[model samples]
Target: MKNDVKEFFDNSEHRPPKFGVLQGVKVVFSAIEVAGPLGPHFMAEWGADVIWLENVNGGDTNRNYRPSEHEHRNDRSMSLDIFSEDGMAVFKKLVKEADVFLVGGKGPSFIRKGITDEFLWAINPKLVITRISGYGQEDADPNYIDRPCYDGIAQAMSGYMSQNGTPESPMPAYPYVGDLFTAMFSLSSTLAALIRARETGKGESVDIAMTEVLMRLSTYNMVDYLNDGRMYPRPGAKDPIQGATGIYKTKNGFLFTNILGRKQMKTLFNMIGCEELYGVGDFKEGFSFINLNWDKADYVESKVEAYFKTKTNEEHIEIFDSMKVAAAPVLSFKDVVEHPQYKARDMWVDWDTMTTEEKYKGVNVVPRFKVNPTKIWRSMPHIGYDNDVILEDLGYSEEQINELYHKGVIFRNDRDK
Candidate 1:
């Protein structure tokens, strides 16, 4: 019986099969903040093995940005002082093994630290390196590269803030304008470089400026201004592509409706119990009543607003559904959490936090995959938490790891204590 059991155990599966889109790819991330860190977060979600490298001190400043109670406990921290010789040596070794390198620091700082592109490329010629900055690579004035900037600065320079908000009520846009888009662009470039490497066995450097990415987002407006010399004024909730599409205050919150053409206008009119307006001369097919006469918009909008005020959002939804009109309620954060559509689509997920006893939840995963489903592997790690494990994976022995710790080449909580 013992021999039979032993044989069965030996024959059973020893390791689970690897089944991820980027199963075998390895990425070494030395990025910080949203622009740098988000790149690896995306790559890791897609199944790449990403090792985050941090300095010997506390870690990236972003870790302190609104931490939940649960994140403090489970995350491991690593300390590597890159300014020191031993720290640089360890980092260089890690770069040698990495297929992709992502950095968000400026070129001058990297050059000063001896981690320049030339040095990194020399270590691994086939390495896909992405460098993200506030401004860009070219600058006629030397002081341009020296200027420090953040997401808001990039947004202002790239015309994103100017296009957002209304002409009368202009305000600052979201703070993460360039950072988020820069990460997406960097990831795209990295993937492209990876594909090129697979085909030609050569890699290239991808330089992404946050301002440049933000500028790309405003290309349509730029083209309009360049060709027609007409700067577009800030539009409110109304869409430029489709007229009579805007947000209206409902009984509960808000509702977005688009009654652009005669067909949709007729459907809306019928839904609102104003069926007499459908066959009117001004509402005829290709009449251009709303488009040609601006004053008609105010009259139509006032009637639509008054009609919408007669019913609750739920009632309006039912009416729209029955009429087959394109309409939806403007959902708030609280409403979104309890929304049936989000629940049905499995869009929101809960991640355990280490900062407190109670579990914390956030929107970490987004809806993309349908057939082969994937889950959140872990919440964002604490500062340098995977340091020892990563070093060990790099073939450093326990004794050597300890020695590096004493030399300030690595960091751990117990050592700090």
Candidate 2:
């Protein structure tokens, strides 16, 4: 209560010498896995004062996974038994000063735990309480609202999986798109709510459902069916309606081309020695020749395939560039890391992990800002690493802090094993 936030920044060793655009904002997030924690990680990079609340049991389950290193950075970890009386007291004090609080799990679970919006708004009137879940907080069926779900389940339930991969077998998008997309939605909504809260002096609660986010993303795929009742067959890696937009084998490797515009389509038809196909594109001024020749899809693709087989990757690149065709080589992971464009953009950066002191490389702060630029001032932290400093900031003495730790209200995980 006595600690001035500005004064702490001026004196604390943890403070970065140069902060980001979110320097004055405070965010406290209690998240379990990737879906919950990743949202706040971006805010932390942008200089928000972020505290990650971890359960005393063993901290976030993500800590056991590989991507955990990338998921948690620029955060102070505080392991606490929030279900306990003393722990809730400490949590309430922290929430009293926070601008945003994000939590992950079913809505019913939090309500059962008595951590509802009303309880939090009583502490901080302008707080933006954000909840991340699989199916959101409400539904026509009460049973569905409380159903436990994860990334894959959301993908399957949201129709996202049905539209992906081949018709033979559909596959879920890799690297947890369900979780990451939901996190992105949650971040945007919370920031919007925070802005309104600052202006009108009233808080907002944002409920983000992973399934809903995926369904929204699939709008383009669903619009045709919604209006005309047409369900096109899955085209695998190819565009559903555009025959010329697909991956083709080159002399050396594979290249994907999306020949949509009239000029690009004409260039492809002429180059493939099928100039007669160009006349088929008389539908409109901006119509694509390949699209108009949909009836001759097999013949057109065969010609294009034969033409591509005559050229190497470098030759195809030169031809595409000269013809202004939208095409690129289908790169592998190694090729991506060694790509010249990524290096020129300073995409890769190095940082040392706090606990292991091990060096790691990852992408830098994205969509670089020209002013008050974001930065990675610190790497991932150990569980409850800043317990002393954080408690001290809350006006707790060293003796009281020790007693709290002894009483199991404060906790830390030493992953020495």
Candidate 3:
């Protein structure tokens, strides 16, 4: 088992995979908030030179977030207080040399900061300027455009929250799914534009809206709503599948199951000794029967519940796995992080494994590649830690760097200087 697991990891491991898809590329991150930072985080993993062009006001503010110990690593930080002339000079220098510049904030306010798409384009015609916002790149009325929005706001506006929870009270989905999906879409779209820029010798400003991503993901629900006034809702919805689909409680823990195919339904019925339900097709007959008689739905649910209650979670898992039925335990974080299956699959890594002390936590990169995998090259920068390095790269002398530091145009960790 260990050898097989090792081979599986060796085939897909990120420890020195054939990365460098974005080699020789420079990305300047002029954005600070949550959604803005995410897409670029993945790009940095792809071997690009990502510089965090933070503001001296607070330096990206992500540092102040809870559990932000590892947030300050992996990238170089240079506090570009662009409000000042000297700072704007340094900011322009970075943008002039950058291939992709990520900018975020509200629509009008962010553009008014004097770093427009046109400005960056003229500086570096090949620069792909990417923008992310709650309402997109709007210059509309402040009432709508200037409103503060978060993950829940996107969920509510995009019709996701409406269908997520029970009918008693709709609950917001946790784990920041709304924010994350938006970032993912933005990443892929921006990569496409970056590709186009490389081919066309012209840059593009890609604008992404948070609510729009959620709206696109909620298309199926929109379909039924548009067809009729009724929406395909899941509030208090028991079965997601046609026949048997739900999280069932066993002797030990909860496990989710899906009876999708006719064979699976027949096998489940035989296993439960419910001969009457045998040979019921999942979509064709079982769905019709449940729809026709509410009592039948209740009856089937009760039988499934009873059958699950008779078995331990492990037993249920074993039986289902052996029969090729879909089943999985609803794992918590503690169960997941320590799981042998995930460890064997190389899903995550020990953060401080190579370090002297384990100060940082675990790290799991996103959108794993089969061939050209992404790699983590550096730690998150200390506040303005890359100030000297970036300044020197831009042809600034040590005296010039000291002048900017003394003027408070840049801030850094004391150890940085």
Best by lDDT: 2
lDDT for each residue of candidate 2 in 1-417, tens digit (9 for 90 to 100): 211112222212454434677888899999888788888988887778889999887788888775687777678788888889989988998999899999998655776789999999999999999988878876626767877778899999998888887878888888899988988888789889999999999999998888889999988878878998867666677776667678888899999987777787767777888777566543344456455236677687778789989999889888888878778999998999999998777777766775565676777776566666676766677788667778888888999998888898878664232
Residues 1-417, candidate 1: write the lDDT tens digits: 011111111111212123346656778767667787776666665556777667766777676776322222222234677768777777777788778888786545565567767888788877888877776654514766656657887787778778878878655566576777888898889989988976886777887888789888888778878788767667677654334567877787788976555556666666556566555654564442244234344566667777878788888878777656678888878889898977776555455443445555655344354443333454555555566677787788999888987887777654342
What are the per-model C-alpha RMSD values against the true structure? 6.5, 4.7, 5.1
Ranking, TM-score, top scorer first? 2, 3, 1
Local lDDT at 240 for model 2: 69
**How far in Å is the alpha carbon of 102 misplaced in model 3?**
1.2
Model 2 lowest lDDT segment of ten = 2-11
Better of 2 and 3 by TM-score: 2
Better of 1 and 2 by TM-score: 2
lDDT for each residue of candidate 3 in 86-181, tens digit (9 for 90 to 100): 988888899889888887776656677767777777788999888887777765456767666688998887788887877577767877777788
Off by over 4 Å in 2: 1-18, 281-286, 414-417
- TM-score, candidate number 1: 0.82
Name the weakest run of 10 consecutive residues (lDDT summed) in model 3.
3-12
Which candidate number has the best TM-score?
A: 2
